[model samples]
Target chain A: MTLIQFLAIGLTILILLKTISDFKKNRINLLAFLFWTGLWSSVIIVAALPQITMPLAKISGLERGIDVVVYFAIVFIFFLLFKIIAKLEKIEYEITQIVRKNALQKQNNRPQKKI
Target chain B: MTKLIVIIPAYNEAKTIGNVIQGVKKYTDNIIVIDDGSKDNTYQTALQSGAKVYRHQINRGLGGALGTGIEAALLNDGDIIVTLDADGQHNPNEIPNLIKPIIKGKADIVIGSRFLKNQSMPFFRRLGNYFFNLMTFIFFGIYTTDSQSGMRAFNKKVAQNLKIYTNKMEVSSEIIKQVRANQFRLKETHIKAIYTPYSLAKGQGFFVGLKTLGKLLILKLTQ
Candidate 1:
């Protein structure tokens, strides 16, 4: 096996172990745990047997097996980034609502000044 | 007599907030200053100026502050609500003109347009306003001479129906969008802008304007 393949396999195994640990600690839900496990396991398979991606590359009209993986990785990363942005926006909106409610409640409790 | 409540959303405007409150006091006794987590003494100054003050513990930007101010005004039984900048750029004396349409049952929302009177504004600022006006029209299919005007008067019904979702300078555009969506009667009146070094130093810059446009686009997509 090539040095790159050895390193890729090792890194993916470490990531998969971490994902399992997170699932065990209830840090991620079953769906999330399954997603990460499937993703990393595929990465391990692709790294260990580069020939397995040949059919995927041919069907996707890519020149090489690695090209198929790279394209998928790029698209997946973009999807994750979009999800993160939407989640952050929702969190910000919620925070503003809480702050507004607190400010109004505090103001209401104060002595009413003749306006 | 309509109970007019003036809401001034201020952030670090201690220098001018007191004067702004006092100016608005000439028009209406119901003045509300939303100190959007100012690190200064804006709250105390507004209070000392005899205006009701509500303060956010952390800054939530212009939209958030306006939302709070509108809710507070509605709670206090305000018949009409006016929003003015705390930077003292908006003339409180002209506030009577702004609310006149609402009182006369003509307009549900009146925007104080600086462009209507041929007032002298910085060339770039005018150009920027035109650009944002076009953007507002493009995004929400609503056109206005001054989509970014800080001074606006709306009746209690409009205030209760309006929803401010953004928390930044883009709130100006969002307000225009909401007016279009709710099909409220809108009017524009000429009002002179008081330009001072301090006031000029506070509003949206070129980059902030671009950011506002970007946020407005996102708002359109998400909502």
Candidate 2:
């Protein structure tokens, strides 16, 4: 109908296709693939039929359907951000372990004076 | 006979590594220098100074260096392991007194505290240290005069038991936490800090202190 709605639907379809491709290539697990598929499918539904969000906005005590969608998006984004940060910290810890192991192994292999 | 191993974790301290190694050599020949990916000639200087050097391929922070140093010490069968700053702020002569508690079986770990006695520390630095001490107490339920002290000596058992997870300055606080969790005997002794212009510039400032605090908080939440 509207230009914005058409663009949102197109973008959602593209993202959904990418998520499926990632799942096919084994880049993401079943749980993650299902999550993205559900999320993008909902986005497509919300974009295609803007009136569907009216009940959600009313129940959430929001003035407009767009506000409800925006609030959920913000919450979802924050959750994803927290996950990313936690994963990054774990990766950093792993890297430190690797570096420490290598340094110690190199030293052990070298001949040195007795302590 | 107790074997005392001194571990100096150096990062870009080429100017002082030679002198520091020589100073520690006065007390013990088992000196370990963990060259934490220094861009300078720290590794060469330490080697020339006759200290065994273990170098990281890339820069891991203070904690990472200390972790490597401790492992190296334990591998060499160190009876008592002492860690001090490479900036020459910690006096090597005080090391004998620092490990006295461990040698006598009085304590498993001895912390060389700068705040145990009256010392000339910068006003803000003193205040910041006090703040960190209080935070360590609040988060881990263990209070000490200097939670961030770079000079500490621990027995072999303590070294093997302690796990350093952080790769930054927060490792100091994390060490205190591990000491408490492992129920290790801890003691604090007064030691003077030689704050030269070079060493003063290397100490943690306001922003780094804040980052250390943030990391400590995360450590508390996660662990």
Candidate 3:
């Protein structure tokens, strides 16, 4: 393979790996990883294989097929982040409810012994 | 597990503090009242009612008092803890029901809902609660009957894990948000609310609601 071809393949793999690692560490959903890898794989195929890139780019109204894949991946990642944030909020609501209840019960129970 | 305890956060609630303490003592003996620097004799009256009192040197707001109470409850070997407002809007008779889920190991947290079943609240307050309740459901997918309800119950795990920074009423929203982030089991129980004219007057008005939402937005942005 030429130097450019080799670089394209290596860069795609690197991006896919980095995205997966970030997702795992942050507890991002697995679907997000899949979407990213799909885009990365598209880049390798679009650059290394001219026949696929030329026809697809022309039909999709894009100068480069790889750009479309990257755009899709970015949008998908944002959707995933929103889902995780919503989940976190639900957990917080439950904890607060309990804490407030515990406080009230303590206040109520203080008077019986004194009486 | 150590015996369960209760924490009451009071701020200038001298009018109702004694009755609230008396009402709670009928159900349980483990109680702690944190006077949030009340300008009135809230602390003295609570003490007179026989509650273990922790006086905040200065007014810390509801959230600050709650944080102090939670810290004290943890240190005191409290296995379970319940929190209720000092304004006497929450019914102490519902304590057993709130604690049941924790005892059954089904939930780390339980919230008392005034909107559940037959309970009723004031018109404007109910409208405000419904609006926030819808927002919480839309934003977090947690279908609680009352998002603004001040009464709640927690196990030691939850009480120990809490870290609230909101000094005002938005701490209510913050608590639910934290529970969602931590991925703990949550449940809601039906409870009666006693919203007297005084409490209704003291409750959140339009400006207070705006302030709370703004504070929550700012906190969310900072985090």
The top-ranked prediction according to TM-score is 1
C-alpha-based local distance difference test score of model 2? 0.93
State the TM-score of candidate 3 restricted to chain B.
0.95
Instruction: Kindly provide the TM-score of model 1 when superposed on the true structure, using C-alpha atoms.
Output: 0.94
lDDT of 2 at A73: 99
- TM-score for the second chain in candidate 2? 0.99
Count: clashes, candidate 2 = 0
Report chain A TM-scores, every model.
0.94, 0.94, 0.50
lDDT of 2 by residue, B34-151 (tens): 9999999999999889999999999989999999999999888999999999999999999989999998999999999999999989999999999999999999989999999999
For residues B86-185, could you state the per-residue lDDT of candidate 1 as single tens digits?
9999989999899999999999999999888688888889999999999999999889999999999999989999998899989989999999899999
A50-91: candidate 1 lDDT, tens digit per residue: 998898888988888889898989999988887786777778
Candidate 2 lDDT over residue span A1-115, tens digit each: 9999999999999999999999999999999999999999999998998888899889988888878998989998988887776777778788889999999888878865567
lDDT of 3 by residue, B79-146 (tens): 88999988998889899999999999999999998877865566777889888777666555566788
Ranking by lDDT: 2, 1, 3
lDDT (C-alpha, whole model) for all candidates = 0.91, 0.93, 0.79
Candidate 3 per-residue lDDT over residues A1-115, each given as its tens digit: 6788898889888888898888979756788778777778777776687556566578789888666766776998888776665555555445544555554466456533431
Better of 1 and 3 by lDDT: 1
- Assess the local accuracy of residue B98 in candidate 1 as a C-alpha lDDT between 0 and 100: 91
Candidate closest to the true structure, highest DockQ = 1
Displacement of the residue B166 alpha carbon in candidate 2, Å? 0.8
